[model samples]
Target: MSASIAARNIAGVVLLGLGLAVGSTGAPAVAATTVHTGVATQLGPCPTPTEAPGTEPIPFPLTSSVKPTDTSTSTVIVPDGPQMQCSTTAPTLYEDITYSSPTTGGVETDLKLDLQIPDTPGDKPLVIYITGGGFITADKSANLGQRTYVADQGYAVASIEYRTQLTGATYEDGLADVKSAVRYLRAHADEYGIDASQVAVWGQSAGGYLAAMAGATNGIKRFDIGENLNQSSSVQAVVDEFGASDLAGMADDYDAATQTAYMAPGSFINNYVFGPGSTRTVATDARANRAANPATYLRRGVSAPVVMLHGDQDQIVSPSQTLTYLNALKAKGVEGTRYVVQGANHGDMSFLGDPDAGLLWSTQKVMDVITGFLDQKIGS
Candidate 1:
C-alpha cells in the first residue's frame, strides 16, 4: 500500500481500538492519535510510571519513558488514570514582590512577582511558572491550577508577571525579568524556606520559550540583568510545554501555502520580536533572531536538563521547533527528553476538552511525565 493509505489504515485501527476501549468504560475517548509523517512502526507500549522521591506515591498516567523514532518522529502514552487535583491546604502567598529593573525606569516601574509556597513545612525546591500570551498579554495567575498543584507537591511556586511588548518590553527585557525573579527567589529563600539550589522554571508557549532560554543560558552574564547581580539566577531544570525555541525558524516552518493561510497581522512573531513598525524584518534579521533563540545559548556546560511536552498537531508552534531544540541539546550532550501527545493541539484546553476518558488519561500522562522528570532531575 502507498504510504498515505498505510497511514490511514493504521489511524483507523488505532481509533477503532480506542473507541472500543472507551465504550467499555463509558468515558469519552480523546480522538487523539499519533500522526506519523514518514515510515510507520508498531505502536509502542505505554510507559510504566516512575516513582518520585518523597513519601507521597507517584501520580498516575505518568510518562515512564520517551523514545524518539527518528529526529522527527516519536510516541508518548499515559496509562489510564485517577484524575489529578490540587492540595487542600491554602498556599502562603507573598504578594506582588517588586524587583528593580533598569528597563522600566529603575524603581518607578519595577517588575513584580507573586510567590506561593505550600503551607507544608521545610525548605523546598522552587518552580517559577511563566504564562503564555504571545509575548503581548499574560498575567501571573494564568495557570493557577497547575502552579497550585506543583506547590502542593511540596515545591515553592512563583507565578511571575513580566513585561511584554505592549509595555515596550523586548524579549531581552522579558529574559531580564525572569532572571531577576530567580535571583529574588534565591535571595529570599531563607524567609520562604526554599532550597535555592534546586530551582526549576516551568512555562507554556511564550513562557515556555522564556523557561527554555533561562535554562539553556543559566550563569551566562549577558542575560542576567536587574538587581541582585551578586546572587545567581540559575535553575536546575526546565519544563517547556509547546514553547518556541528558535524565533527565526518559526515563520520558516510553514510552507508557502501554510504561511499564507496562518501568518496574519499582529502575529506573535511579528509584533513581539520585530516591534510595531516593520514587517518581516525581525523574522529575517539573523542577529536579533539569534539573540532571542534558546538554541543560541546552548553549550556543553551551560544547560540544565529539560523535559518538554508538545502536541503533534499543534498549528501555532510546530512540533519541529521542539525537535530541533532537542537535537541541539543532544548534540551538546545536555540531557533532554520530549513527549509528543498524539493528535493533541496547542494548549491545555485541548487536552482538558478531550472526551472524559481522554481527559483523565491525557492529564495523568502529562502529570506523570512532569513529576517523573522533576523527581529524576531536581528531586521532589
Candidate 2:
C-alpha cells in the first residue's frame, strides 16, 4: 500500500486501541477464557450481559491468580480472594496508601503498595512497578501476586497506576501521575520504612516505557506541563521490558498482529508521546519528543542504571527496537544489562505458551533483575 494509505490504516488501528485501553465497562461476567488462576475479574455494573445466541457458556473461575492478603499493617487488610504465592516466605510489612496529583486536573490516581523488609537489618531497597497496557489497560490489582513475590524477596514494591492517552490523556498527564507517585513515596518513605535514597523503578511493556521515561529525563522537566515544574523524583535504577522507547520508531509499517497490538484500544504510545496525527509535533520542540526517548536520554550523569528485557519472537515491539535502544546506551559507555527470552512473545509469560522451550521467563525473573540491580547500586 502507499505510505499515505498505510499511515491512514495505522491511524485506524490507533483509534481502535484508544477505545479498548480501559478494561471492560459493564458488570463483570465469566469469559470463554479465564484471566489466569488467582486474579479475579473486576466488573462494574452493567444493564445486560451481552452474549451471542450461539455462543458457548462463559467459563467459571475467570481470573488468573489471586493476590495474597496484605496484613502487615493493621490498617491495611488484604482483600479476600484466591491469590498466587510466589515464594514460600510471607511478607512482614504491608501498607495501603493513596495519593492525589494535580498533574491531570487534580485527579487523584490510586496505588496499591506492598513494603517487604529483610530480617538482616540493612538499608532497604525500593522498586516501583508500573504494569503494562501500552499506557492504558493495566491496573494495580492485575499485578498484586507479582508484587507480593518481589516483596517476599525483601524489597519494597509499589505497584503504580498512571493516566494513559487512550482517552486523549496526554503524556504530560501520565508522567505527572508517575512523578506524583514517586514524590508521594519519597515524601512518605519513613511511613513505609524504606530508604528513599535506594529507590528503583521497574515495569513491563508500557510500564517499562513509563519507567524509562520517568528515569530518563528526571523530574518535572520530563513532562513539560505540571504544577511543581522543578520537582525531581529520580530513581536509582530502571528496568524496561519490551517497552516502546521511540515513538517515531512506531510510525514504521508493521505486520497485521503487531499493527493491531500497537494500535489496540488501551495503547496510547503514539498519542502520548507523538501527539495526534503522525506528523504532529509531540513536544514543544519536535526534537523534545525524541530527546525524551530513553535511547536519547543516555548521558553523563547519575541517571538510574538500566536493564532491558525482551523476547526475540516478540512481534509487538520489534527486536530491532531493543537493539537500537541498547546500542545508544552502549555508545554512551553507560552500564546496562539485557536478557532476550529466546522464543517468547512480547510480554507473554511463556514462549508462545510452551513449557519445554526452556526460555519461559516469568515475572519472577524480571523481579530478580530489579532486585539484583538495586543490590548492586544501593546494597541490600
Best by TM-score: 1
Query: How far out, in Å, is residue 354 in model 2?
Result: 8.9
Worst 10 residues of 1 by lDDT: 14-23
Q: Against the true structure, what is each candidate's TM-score?
A: 0.74, 0.65
Off by over 4 Å in 2: 1-85, 92-96, 103-123, 219-232, 251-267, 274-292, 349-359, 363-367
| Global local distance difference test of model 1 | 0.63
RMSD of each: 14.8, 13.6
Model 1: residues with Cα > 4 Å off, grouped in runs: 1-75, 78-80, 101-108, 251-266, 280-282, 350-362
Per-residue accuracy of model 2 over 1-380 as CA lDDT, tens digit each = 33322222322222111000121112121111211122222322111113211111111111111112122211211122332235544445444444433333344343334344434355467778776655555454434445555665667777665676534466656665666666666666665567778777877776777777777655435453333233347777888776667654542235544444444333344466554445344323348557657766666565567777765544345545555666667777666666665444444322122222212334335445556666787656
Which candidate's lDDT is highest?
Answer: 1
User: Local distance difference test, per candidate?
Assistant: 0.63, 0.51
